[model samples]
Target: MTAIHDVAIIGGGLVGASLAIALEGSGLDVAMVEAAPAGAMPAVFDERNLSFAEATVNALAALGVMQRLRAPTGAIVRIHASRRGDFGRVLLEAAEHGREAFGQVVVARDFGEALEARLSGVAGLVRHRGTRFTGFGAVGDGCRVLELAGEGPPRMRARLVVAADGATSGVRDALGIGASRHDYGQVLMVARLRAARAPDGTAYERLGDDGPTALLPRGDRAWGLVHGVAAADAEAVKALDETGFLARVQDAFGWRVGRLLSVGPRSAYPAVAVRAAALAATRAVLVGNAAQSIHPVGAQGFNLGLRDALTLAGLLVACARRGGDPGEASLLSAYVARREEDRRRTLEFSDGLARITANPGHAASLLRSAGLVALAALPSLRAGLVGGAMGYRGDVPDACRSGAAR
Candidate 1:
């Protein structure tokens, strides 16, 4: 006989873990299956800092993760975007947004550890940390059997399956859902570095012919730099010695934050825009990077993923309380509807921005440069762009609006 759970979450990354925490005390049995080793914690720094806009900050605070982050992480009080050789720019100040700061910047590890610590207190949650999903099949109405490695035969069963398994989700593939993926022909270099100038809670973005470079504030002492470069140059940048790497970064980034003193080991990832064709099926759903992996050009990947988790959690918790099947088609359809705007708009924005900013032709360059200048000059246009940065009017999850219910 298979032990049953209310929900089986495949993937114990940030989004999956957070959703499990959110479902605590809701009378639902939750289990998270991770492909990694047991109790494996995420790294402290991944060369990319999580940039949380105000909306995301609120969403995190609501989920109770932000309060646990404490200090040593940084807040972004201002965001500046501009194009080189283009006489245009857009600025988003926290004051203008009527918030304390546009968002908070936290090291990926800080975010993960804080969340893991919180999960300890949430009752009725089981984490299958080291076990991975070998396969899954529909067993009966409202239940599915899951097979895991190094464990007894296919023992875990659940009414609903949530695949937060990430961009290359095996569960998604096993479900036989297809996706649309685009390789941007560019690579993103991410690093954490010590800077000569204090960041002062400011985030900077400069779009050049090579690519867009984003410098996000990290605490008061460090900074997170993301440099997007042509694919041909990616290996060279990643291969550079520390000194050579810093020089390349300094050259591409200029002295916006003064000189970069020291950089941590560098990491590089091929940039791509990916989207799962369907967010849900009859008895399962995909959230976070499992649904889509947008370019990291704007640090919107995780935030958007959080929204997916948030929305799905809310839908499940509410329905479960009302004696409804959390994974029923009705519930899943509602989730898909709620997330459409967010997924569509964000994908478009990230893809479009990357395409234009990376354009090398004189004509394309002229058009983008002029557009940037025009965006800076028009107050309405600037605010619109800034609002998007602050996380407004996209497909937001209901849990993002409501605190994780007790």
Candidate 2:
């Protein structure tokens, strides 16, 4: 007899692994199909620093993911945002919100390792490493059958198939869903640096005419930087020697972090925004980068994706408790309705911020100045920004909530 699972998760990247872990204790039988080989980091888990929102950190902690991280994570106690060549600026401190820190920071590589360790201990969760999901073969008998290649079953059956496969999701494509894409014409460079000044639990984001340069704190008193450059200039910038590259970073970010004495290997990422036309199709649903891929402007990409995974997990687990089918049309519709608000607001904010800051025109300059001034002066406005940044926008999941999760 061909074995059937309650859920077959496609991709097994950060978001896919997260969904499996989130379903750890649920009665559902879960299987994760991943393309990466055993003991290899997933392609997405590169040497990039990720800024986790407070809610995201809380949720990961609840999932027992944080405790497994071997690398030391850094806390974000404050944030300073400003525009270059402008007098106005906005500052937010965690203390004002009665919190110890706004969130945390982790290297993507370390996070992948931590999640792998956590997954190893998840009871009854099946992992198919180095596997490929070919396409959906059929949907019948209250389940969908997946045609796959590699180590897993050639054919697998599941009540639900979650497309956590990332932006270029084959599952979503197979489902006949379309995605709208926007190219920002910019490339973001990331690297670690030793600064003359210690980070001191603060993160700095300096908006420039060309792009934004952000400095995030690290546990070793160093700094992690994400600097934006024009797409045409990326190669020229990448060709520079260590000293020359350090000079470029120092110029873009100023002396706020003092001298950038040394830098590690650098990676460049092109900024492209993608939004799926729909969140669910047939008995399948999309999560993480599969559903939406936004700019790294506010460092909200992963945070938003995590929320999508958690929200869906909560709904599916509830259905399991009721002995209900995991992939019913009505249930999938409810997931769409539940996620629409937060997803819309996050995409708008990320896209709008990226566009608004990329322009060097007088109008954009004025708007930037006005925004910083309002944030500095109005508590309500500052509160709103912090609330969103902390991942409290709408329909937050149980694990992401405060108190117990905290």
Candidate 3:
């Protein structure tokens, strides 16, 4: 007989793994469906640097994932924002907000390793690694039969299914859920760069004609470089030698982080904004990139997705406590309602930033400079911006509020 799980999460990437960790010891039988093999890292977790919001850091700590990390993390004590050829700049400090740090940066591989380590110790959690979610069928009231493509049992019943399968989610497609996609006509090339000066917990974002270039501090006195290039220029940019690339980056970013010493392996991907038509349907719901994939202008993608996982976990725990069906329409409705504000606000913020800064006109540049000045000069505006950056703009979840997992 196929074992039934209280909740089966599709996609074991950051968001999906996070959801699994958040629900630990919640008295609900949970299963994670992953296409990758156990202990193997996904391509998404290689070399890329992830910036965690303060709320996300707390949530990860509460889930016990932070303690398991083997790689060193860089704290973001301040943010320096500027526009190329603009006189005005904005500096946001954690100290001003009475916080130790606005966020922390971690290499994706390190975080993946931490999540894998924590997953091994979670009791009552089943991991179906190397298994792909093919589709699903209505089994009975408050449950659905999940079909899999792998060596194990082909089908299992799940009371609730959470889709965290990323932007191109198969489960979402199978469900006939439509997504609106907007291509930004830009590609972001990412690499690890060494700088002359040691990192002092400062992150930099420079806006120019090409696009926004971000330098996020990492361990080992290096920085994670995200250089956005126009679609037509992506190939030429990739073809540049290390020295040429460094020169181009220096020209775009100015002398913010001292001299660039060296660069590691590089990877590039096209940027697109995708949002699902609906967040929930029947016994399944979308979370993270599966529900919406926003541009990484403000580094809000994963932070927002982590919030999704945390909020859903809280709702599931509450449902389990009350002996209510996990897949009940009421539960899904409540989950959507709770998350609506945060999701909308984050999507708008990220999309707006991407659009406004991409324009190269003098008027646009002046507007950008004025906005930065406002953020630095106006206490009310600064507070609201900092609050959103720290991931504190929406309904707070218990899992994120507690210092440690219950």
TM-score of each: 0.94, 0.98, 0.97
Superposing every Cα of model 3 onto the true structure, what RMSD results? 1.3
- Candidate no. 1 TM-score: 0.94
Q: What lDDT does model 2 reach?
A: 0.90
Error of 3 at 294 (Å): 1.0
Top lDDT prediction, candidate number: 2
Query: lDDT tens digits, residues 1-406, model 3?
Result: 8779999999999999999988887899999899898667766788888999888888899888988888789999999988888778889999999999999999999999998888888898888888898888666856889999885569889999899999999988987899999999999999999888778999999987667899998875789999999999999999999999999899888887789888898999898999999999888899999999999989999999999998899999999999989999999999999999999999999999899888888898788888878877899998999999989877867666556754
lDDT of each: 0.80, 0.90, 0.89
Stretches off by above 4 angstroms in model 3 are 139-141
TM-score of 2: 0.98
In the predicted model 1, the residue pairs found to clash are 88-373, 342-395
lDDT at position 95, candidate 3: 98
28 Cα displacement, candidate 2 (Å): 0.5
Total clashing pairs in model 2? 0
Question: Model 1: runs farther than 4 Å from truth?
Answer: 42-47, 151-153, 398-406
lDDT (10s digit) by residue, model 1, range 1-406 = 6778889999878889888877876788888886665567744224467888767777777777787885577888888887776666777677865667878888787787778778778877887766778777666866877777754334588888999988888889988899999998888788788888978888998887767888888984788888878898887778889888888878877898888899887778888877999998768899998999998777788888888888888888889889998778899899999999988888888888888887778888778878877876787887787777767756665545543523
In angstroms, give how far residue 43 of model 3 lies from its true place. 2.1
Q: Candidate 1, after superposition: displacement of residue 146 in Å?
A: 1.6
